[model samples]
Each structure stands twice: as C-alpha cells, then as structure tokens.
Target: MSGIGVLREGPLHAAVKDLLARPGDVTEVKYGRYVIDLVRADGELVEVQTGGFSPLGPKLDALLDEHRMRIVHPVPAQRRIIRVDANGEVLSSRRSPLKGEVWDVFDRLVSFPSLLAHPNLTVEVLLCAEDHIRAPEAGRSRSGRRRRDPGERRLTEVVGSEVLASPADCAALLPDALRAEPFTTRELATAVGCRMILAQRIAYCLRGMEVLTDAGKRGRAPLHVIAA
Candidate 1:
C-alpha cells in the first residue's frame, strides 16, 4: 500500500498525526492558538494551509511575528501561494506544482466542515475545484433489467397525479367571497397554489366568459377581480 493509503486507513486524528510525523527538517507541535494543529521546525512555525484568504491568515502571521519566527505553510498542490509583506501588501506568489497520490489523500482527509464549524478556526471553503471530480459508481445488479414493486408504483402514481391535479381543483374551489374581491394575478395564484402566469391565463379566460375583469395594474403586475 502507498503512504497515502496507509494514511487514509485510520481516523482523521491519526491521519493528521501521521502527516505531521513525516521526516522533515521541522518538528510539529500538536496545538496552537485556539487548539488548532500547529507544528514547529527549527523554531519556525509550520502550518498546513488550505481554503482561501481570510482574517486567520493575517492573525497567524501576526502570532508568528510576535514569537520572532518564520512560517512555512504547505498549501494544496493545485493552489497558488499568496505572500503578504509586513504592511500586508501582496509581495509575490507561485502556483504549487507538486502533484501526487499523497496530495489527493491530503485533500480528502482534511475535514473542511469541521474546520469551518470551529469557533476559533474561521476557515471557509471558497472557490474549491474538487467538485469537478466525478462520483464513483455503485455496483450494478447482475441482471440488466430493473424491477419495481406494484405498491411502490401505485403510491408514486397517486403522488404524481395529486401534484398535477391540485392546482386546477384549487382554482375551481376558490371561495365566492375571494372570487368576488379584486385580486392580482399573483394574489389569485397564491390562493390557488398555481403559478402567476397560469393564474393570469385563467383570469383572461374568465374575463372573456364575463366571470372576471381586469382591475388595472398593481405596480407592474396585472390585477383581476370578479365581474358581475
């Protein structure tokens, strides 16, 4: 098994520990500001950085400067590093070129939801490209034909018919008081649980039949009231 596969075997906590344990020039500290994952190497702070720009970046920079140490931020392989000077002016950046199985593992293993929900960690997923990855297919049945139960079919048909028939039935059942009162296309639609466009068409038909009349415009939308 690859290193990435081994890393993926355990829970997130163990996976993160394994990532930090990789032989490097730096020694990782388990916790830092707000108990987030932090590492130290040769007195410099090392952080695995993901997501986009936010206040946390500046705050971490400030903390590192306060401790008189430099920071090494390992960003995702596809992302570009952003550098801000002492005055917060963007200095320079280069697109990260390192791509491998381990990088993919790192991307998936990181719990973005947990990080975003953290009270102290204000990490937010912005402009993520991972949605482009296609979903895996589930195993297919041996026989190609799909089978449907009769009860399920009847239930589905009933639900579909009700959804299709409700609006027309509701319009037919409109109270005499409401039908007599002046209403807009939208108001009538709201009362009948139908689309405004459909309501307008119905009102137009009713007007031609002398059962409804256009009561002029309410703002840009048309209004209709019952005709005597």
Candidate 2:
C-alpha cells in the first residue's frame, strides 16, 4: 500500500480513482472546498474526471493555488452499450461501433482552453474500455431528441496512458504520418478520415498549447502547423 490503502469504491469514478491511487494513498479528503480524489506520495493531488471539464474550472483554480494537481481523464477506446430494465436486468448489449482516439480528449479540453498553461496542472489521458449502462426508454426523450444520456459509465480496464505535462506533449496525439507542412482543418480531417468538427477541436487545443501555430487561413478555414 502507498498512502492509506483503498478507502472505498463503488461507482466507476471511485473504481478508477482507486486504481490510479498509489498503494496506501488517501482516497477522498476534503481540502479547501473540493473533495480531492487521491493524494499521492509526493503530495500531488489527483482528480479523476470522467465527465465534462467545465464544472472543474473552479475546483482546479482553487486547488492549483496551493497544491500541484493532476487530472486523470479517461477516454473510452472501446465501449459496450448495455441496456437494462429498471430492475437492472440486461435487455440488450452491443459493442459500440464508434472507437475513441486520443484526440477525443479535445472535446472536453474545449471547455477549458487555458487550464493547460498552468504550471502546477498536468493531465493524464487514459485510454480505457468502458461499459455504458442505460435504461430502456419508451420512445423519444423529454427533449424530443434522437440521442440521450448513457446514464452511467463504468470503466472496465485501462488500455494506455499519455501524460500532457507540457506543450510538446500535445504533439504525441498527432500521427507520425502527418506531413510537416501547413495544413487546414479540412486537410487534417481528410488525412485522418475524421469529421471536420473533431479536427477543429484538435487544432484548437494544439494552438492553445502552443504546439501548433496559426499559419493564417485558406479560403474560409484556418491553417495550422507544428510549431518550430
């Protein structure tokens, strides 16, 4: 054990937190206004965020003022959608056709573009297998939309991890095959065979991290290139 030993675990959040904690480390402790997820051996506070980053802005701001902090955000590389009835009986199960990539973290990073610049803040991106639990819905949701929340996300296992400790780390997400020339979002999207929106988000984070520089624009799209 590291710090205090596993204090407790239940939901996916706690389970992931427990797994990330150094053996014997404290699990949950109230510090200032936030209930920190784990306190490591060297005193770095670790928070496992499996949700959006918007809500964490204030929490991170408060903690980083006095302590070194790490945000462990997991991106599900493989997901299984398991639909169950209200009683928790499995009704249907299927592997989601969509696969997650490292760039997917940009979806959440868009919420806090400046957080990465903080000296005390580090983000550990974990690629993992997840189980998405949902309940059977009658028809359309109250929003009258086609998509609905997955209800709960349970992490089954970790695949790999990438640490973004500096602006250079952002380049790790880029493919080695990417040309060393200036590229627009459209070109990047076409090269990766991904949606333009995702490419835009990736570009946004790269620019924010100073890993990519704005090379002006082409037509109506912005151009970006790896910083020298």
Model 1 Cα lDDT, one tens digit per residue, 1-228: 123323322232233334444445333343344223343443434333332223345545445444422212222224334444456455565454542211121132132212222222222111221111112222456686544211100000100111111223323445565665677767866776555565665555455444556788878877776645
TM-score of each: 0.25, 0.87
* Backbone clash pairs in model 1 (N, Cα, C under 3 Å; residues 3+ apart or in different chains), count: 2
Error of 1 at 97 (Å): 49
Per-residue lDDT over 1-228 for candidate 2, one digit per residue giving the tens place of the 0 to 100 score: 233323443367777886887765786777866677788878999888877888788888787878999988888899999999889999999999888877777888998766787889898889999998998765776788766655788889999988987676777667665657788888877776678899888788878888888888888877888878
State the weakest 10-residue window (summed lDDT) of model 2.
1-10
Q: After superposition, how far is residue 193 of candidate 1 from its true place, in Å?
A: 0.6
- Judged by TM-score, which candidate is best? 2
The numbered model that scores best in lDDT is 2
lDDT of 2: 0.80
Clashing pairs in 2: 1-23, 2-23, 2-24, 3-24, 3-25, 4-24, 4-25, 5-24
Please list the residue runs of candidate 1 whose C-alpha ends up more than 4 Å from where it truly belongs after superposition: 1-172
Error of 2 at 23 (Å): 2.3
